[model samples]
Target: MGRSRVALKFNLGRGVLLAPLIFLTIFYFYPLVSILSVSLFPAGRIDLSGFSEIATSAYYHRIVWFTIRQAIISTVLTILLALPCAYLFARYRFPGRSILLALTTLPFVLPPVVVAIAFTSLIGRGGLLNRLLMSQLGLSSPPLQFEQTFAIIIIVHVFYNFSIALRMMTGFWMNQSRRIEEAARVMGAHGWRLWWTIYLPILRPVIAASGILVFIFTFTSFGVILILGGVRFATIEVEIYRQTTSIFNLPLAAALSLLQIAIMTAMMLAYTRLQRNLPLELQATRHTLQNLSTRRAYTLIILLVSFIAMMIFTPLLALVVRSFMSSTSGTFSLRFYKMLTVNTRSSILFVPPVDAIINSVKFAFITTLLASVLGMMAAYLLARRGVFFARWIDPLFMLPLATSAVTLGFGFIIALDEPPLNLRTSPMLIPIAHTLVALPFVVRSLLPALRRIPPNIPEAARMLGASPVSVWWLVELPLMLRSLVVGAVFAFTISMGEFGASLFIARPETPTLPVAIFRLFSRPGAESAGQALALSVILMGVSFVSFLVIERLRTPGTGEF
Candidate 1:
């Protein structure tokens, strides 16, 4: 009877595993394989020529070099900027500190296109900085022309990714053992020596993890480059879209896609290894922020806070300001907001702009439901078991997070066109793709909470004559409710702001908010630009509310990203 029960349990676990495995295979792996096959067998035969052409071409070589260079520069700049802020947040408490931290994270949830537009509004040729410079200097032309430059690209990448470095490193730093630092100080190590010998070694792993994540994100950047960098600059992601959609070069697109996936997969593997090797005891000790005590400290803190405030808030403020300004009057007005309700016959969009909000919210709701359910199951399985399968399964679930959305969207176009699972024109594909991207976040949020539940609580319930299902429903469910909410919010916001996949899959008549904003920006005229800014403000509002809920619900010290 015991043997039979063990076999039953094994079968149940295997069945649970099969659901996600099949979903990933159909939606993720199959699409990837389709792209590879198209590239390698372009003419119903094996073709090594595409790979050779990519390798030998000087244009492709320059692109590859630029991608790596920009990513590295962005990563370094983000870390440098984020370190001081992280130190301040981790070690010093002040008025409105939590609010400041939350504000710093706002950019993370904004769409890359919105971010690109915001930066352009602040520093483009006709932007605020140039206008100010021209008016003050009496120049006919705008002097600060930053558009399409390497410097502008790097600056925007840092703006978009700085929060990751800040949050991750701050959480890690707050939980670190301060005894090492104290010990080094006592042993005559001070200033740079103390940092170089003690803090640096302890923080290396976290820095590495944060750097790798930032690099992966910047490497796959698409919307930002496309909107801000213009035709002169293209990442692998932007080039993939151009090659596939505009130029109709499928073989080259597939080859580039393959190269991107290979590099990202390697980086993800390295990140997984680093995470595993991180010291478990680093989480044992916790630190409280200290009150500012010295004049020097106050000066430093004020300067850092001001810099962070300016860096994060300026672009958003500019965007909001631009949204209200009327093109004809050059004064603040509600014209753009009112224009969103109008369904002009001459509009490029098939539907009114307001309908895009409805579509975005609808898709986000469905994505939250699907991602939460699947992510909960995956997290439960990993937390409840300590088997060989669990070891490999964790990384497999994270693969989607590391994969480029542009590549995944391209893959979907090619792979899901046939009969058994045709989803080409189906609106359902947007939610499905969004769910894939959001699943990793949901799993990350829930896994920690699930793991925190004491094993004895469930065992105690069983001892009191409760069935396994009853124990799970009565105990585990209640305990994990907050985390579940956090996960759902994350999934919702991700779906709402999703741009890359939606770009490929969305129909003309049923555009989501991000898609609508992109469309608005694609057209010329001040009216279109104003509408784009207005829609972006709406998207930003939604994301901010979602993030506030996440902040209220998330457990302290649990890393979000």
Candidate 2:
């Protein structure tokens, strides 16, 4: 009887594991299969025409090469910028270090559209410096045209990806013992010699991992290229968007989407293998903070300060300054902001900006809740490592994220819109799509937190005559809350600025903020575009403040939950 009960329990656990697998097969794989089916077997015949088109097209090849070239440049630049800064943040502690670190990380949480908008505000023709130059020096022509250039795209990619390198590498750096640095210092090594000999060698693997991750992200980038490069520069994603929606060529679009998936899958497979070997143990160093007194030290500090100031402050000031300036007058005015927030239109379909804001907030809330709960379940199930179906189930949730937005959007349109259930027009689909992508992040984020919880704590609680619920509430809930909140914030932020899926799933009647911004920017004039820029700032500001509050709550030296 006891054996039968154990078998029953095992079966029940197996069923629980299959829950997400079922969801994955239905929502994730089915949509992909549907796309492939439609593409390859359209008109009831298998066809290689789509693939042939991609193979023969020089335009497609050029776009692919351009994207790879730009992504490589951005990745290299980001690593160069991140390595020294990450080393400083991890190995040293000076006055205002924490604040500086936080500021440096600002670009990471800001939405892609938001970052692109900020860059445009700062560097576009007739922007802050250009206007100033014209006014002061009587210059008739602007020196730089940031829009529709490859360089601008690369700059935007670097701005967004630089922090990933810093954060990941810094975590690796923090785990290293100070004895290595100390020994190097004792051996007549100072400044560059010490970092080159002792630190850089040890940090290679971490730097490589971070670089690979950032490269994949930048390589598959769509938002930065579209807004910054305008119509001239096209990545695979941009091409896919143009081919499918703009030009209405489904075959070529399908081909590009498949090619993107193949490339991304290859990259992801390599990254996952590398990740398995990653050094997960991050030990806290106990060395006292160093003080800067020498002239060399002062020079190094000045350079570091200037770099940070230029990277963080300049772009932000440019964003705000441009937001205040009218593109018409090429002078500062607060009218754009006013036009953004003060919406007087009274139509249910074309709702006000305030309605979009409220819709976005609500969608973010629901998605965050769903992602956190589902992610916790998935993580808990995977942690056990004994379930029969766990191996197959684990990677399924990440499929939505690995697949390109254009493909997923196409998939969602095909799969969900027709059936016993039509979710195409439903506003809930936006949050659902956002949750699908954000769920993987929450799972990844919370897994480490859940692993850190000792098994014995719950057992001890249960041994003391406490029920399972009581044990969970008393011992596990308190410990996991902070990490859960962090994970939820990530979900919320991603949902708030979600574009790819939102483009397809969002209703004409109830558009998310990103969708609204895109709509406004796609029009004919600077008024709408400038207003879009203002909305982008508002979005970035909200996410930034939320992240700041969360970071403050989780400050170093604060006791763990």
Candidate 3:
């Protein structure tokens, strides 16, 4: 009787595990594998012709080099900019520090379309900068036209990715016990020597991890390059979008997408190799914030905070102003908000910003649900280390994140758009596209929670003759509810603003919010443009709400399931 109960418990665990595997096979793996096959294999044959076109084409070679070079510059700049900020935020306590941290993190989550429009109104030819430059600065010509330039691309990329480096480094830095630093200072290490010897070495793993993540994100970046990058530049992602969507050269687009995947996969593999030797035993100490009292240190901190505030707030403020104030008419009106509710335009592509809001909310909710469930299951299975299909399944979930969404979108166009699948035009495709992008976050967020559960609890429960369902219901599930909720929220927000994959898969009738905002900017008319800005404002609000809600949900003492 005891053995039979144990067998039943094991069977229940296995069944719970298999549920996610089955889910992935249907929604995630099948779509991704099918897409991969379609991209590389031409019709009935495996061929190198697609790759050959990419390798041999001078245009593609230029794009590949530009992509690598810009990403490197962006990564390095982001690290430089983020490191000091991270140090300040993690170590120092001051008035409005929490507010400052929140402000810095705000832009990272805003929709790419919104960011692009905000950037355009600030720096474009007829933008505020140029107007100020010509009128106030006594300039005959505009000195700062960053549109379509590499400088613009790099700045935008840096602005977007700075938080990645900051968050990772700050988390790692805050975890560090001050004892080592105190010991180093006591041993006569001072100034740069202290940082060089004590802090740098300790921060190396975190730095490397953050750098790798930022590099991957910028390397495969799509939306920034597409709108802000304009005509002068084309990354592999932009090239794929242009070739496939605009030109209808699906074959060439597939080739470019495959090349991008190959490059990214190779780069990730190299990073993994380097990261393997990194020591993980350095644990963090519990933190209580400290004040910067020294004259020079306080001055420096103030300067850094001021610069970050300006960098983050100025463009966003410009966006807010443009959303409310009229640029073309040079007057203020509530028409933008009204237009958001009532689509006054006759364009076939126009979705009222209000409708887009509903669509975005629905899509985000579905994505959160699907990604959270799959991720929780996968994390549980992998945490055990000896679980069935663990090794094979883990990498598959991460592929969507590591690979460019443009590549995946291109793959989807080729694979699922056809008869055997024919899911390309389905309204559900956008949610699926979002889930693909959000799956990695789900897995990463849940892994720690899963690992925190002690193996002994289940064992003890089983020894007490608890049934299989009861053990999990009474033991494991209780510990995981918070993690699952946190992961779900991340998945939702990520999907809501997701742009790259949506570009290829989203149909005209069921456009997501980001897609709607882009369509607004694609043509002319000041009212429509302001409506887009207002919609962007709405997006920013939605993103902020989601982020705050998730933070609250993830907070300890709050029961979230």
**Model 3 per-residue lDDT at 459:** 85
Which runs in model 2 stand beyond 4 Å of their true positions?
A: 1-16, 188-190, 279-302, 326-333, 341-349, 385-395, 554-561
Order the candidate numbers by TM-score, best to worst. Answer: 1, 3, 2
Give the least accurate 10-residue stretch of model 2, judged by summed lDDT. Answer: 552-561
Q: Enumerate residue pairs that collide in model 1.
A: none
For model 2, what is the error of residue 206's alpha carbon versus the real structure, in angstroms, after optimal superposition? 1.9
- The CA lDDT at 97 in model 3 is 62
Error of 1 at 41 (Å): 1.9
Worst 10 residues of 1 by lDDT: 275-284
Residue-wise lDDT of candidate 3 within 199-316, one digit each (tens)?
Answer: 8888787687678778888998889988888788888888888887789866677667666777777666555444333323233455667787888769878897788867877788
lDDT of 3: 0.75
Please, what is the whole-model Cα lDDT of each candidate in the order they appear? 0.85, 0.73, 0.75
Higher-scoring candidate on lDDT, 1 or 2: 1
Candidate achieving the largest lDDT: 1
lDDT of 2 by residue, 405-499 (tens): 66778887877878765877887777777878788777766665666677888878876877656876888878877777777887898788788
lDDT per residue, candidate 1, 1-561, as tens digits? 569657866886777687777878888999999999999999999887767878999998988888999999999999988877777777887777766777777888788879877887888887777878899999999898888888888988999899889987887788887888888888899978986898678778889988998999999999888888998999889999999999998889999999999999889888867765553635567877689898877887898779987999898888888788777776889999988976544756457789999999999999999999888888887777466677678778878878999999999999999888899989999999999999988987887788778899988997797765788799999999999998999999999999999999899988999999998888888877888899999999898888877877776556545
